[model samples]
Target: MTQPDRDPGLQPERTRLAWRRTTLSATVAAILAAKTALHGGASAAGLVACAACCVLWLGFLLVAHRRIRDLAVPGRPTALAPRWATGAVLCTVAIALCAAALVV
Candidate 1:
């Protein structure tokens, strides 16, 4: 089979997949953090941290959406998204801390 010529343009599917992965990570992190904070012997300080993480998680999604939209226009130049996967990562860290503070 002959291969088709590929443009250097951004792959839309790749962008969608990246977004899906980010969203899923955020959701999983949120669920885990909330659960651990609520049931895993979370301290007042730990709970506050978890809440902050949840906020970060939401922020990540918003940033990701904005980035995707910006990248959608082929000829439009835009600033790159921040390197930090803030929300999902923050949530994960918060859950880990909560689990440690409470369970471990």
Candidate 2:
């Protein structure tokens, strides 16, 4: 038995674009977090939160970049692994929390 040809259509392209948009959003969030942290007198806690935000942003970027690269491959891309998905979600949530902390 043989598998039938699958029409990839624009799905891969769309997914890749979505990831790019997400990366851009994350970048903006990180910048805002830093700005908020600095707008107030740079307290030790604020600086620490800012640093955490940057680290989380980097983590997300790594995950998004890998997924985008995988989508660009010629053949059918593999499904996202559970571990990577979890990591991405955790990073996103952590970034949001850090940003909120900086604002508050």
Candidate 3:
């Protein structure tokens, strides 16, 4: 027997779940950054920047999750997370710099 056509809504649901997973990973990364700064004897400037990046990254995650939930509803168009991606890139850079500070 032939399978029935899949609903378009499934696309958004899958995308939403992917976003949630990404956000969760980001939160964990932020935590790791903080721990590295605290225990690695990172320089003051580096530690501060890493900590700030963690806070900002969390904010991005929160906003992305909220937007995904809102988009899951039938009436709303999907909201793309441009800001979150940008924040993630910046946070990665900050974390890298902090790690470097620990070694050098």
Specify the highest-TM-score model's number. Answer: 2
Give lDDT tens digits, candidate 1, residues 1-104: 53344335546647656877978877787677677667757778768867865776677677677767766665544556445455545645755665576455
RMSD of each: 5.3, 4.0, 4.8
Candidate 2 local distance difference test against the native: 0.86
Worst 10 residues of 3 by lDDT: 1-10
Q: Against the correct fold, how does model 1 do in TM-score?
A: 0.58
Better of 2 and 3 by lDDT: 2
| lDDT of each residue in 1-104, candidate 3, tens digit only | 53344444577778778878877877786677677667757778757867676676766666676768775776445556687567657765665665676447
- Tens-place lDDT per residue, model 2, 1-104, is 54344444768888889999999999998898888887859989988988998899999999999999998886688898999889889998998888767656
Instruction: Give every collision pair in model 3.
Output: none
Q: Which runs in model 2 stand beyond 4 Å of their true positions?
A: 1-8
C-alpha TM-score for every candidate: 0.58, 0.85, 0.61
Local distance difference test, each candidate: 0.65, 0.86, 0.67
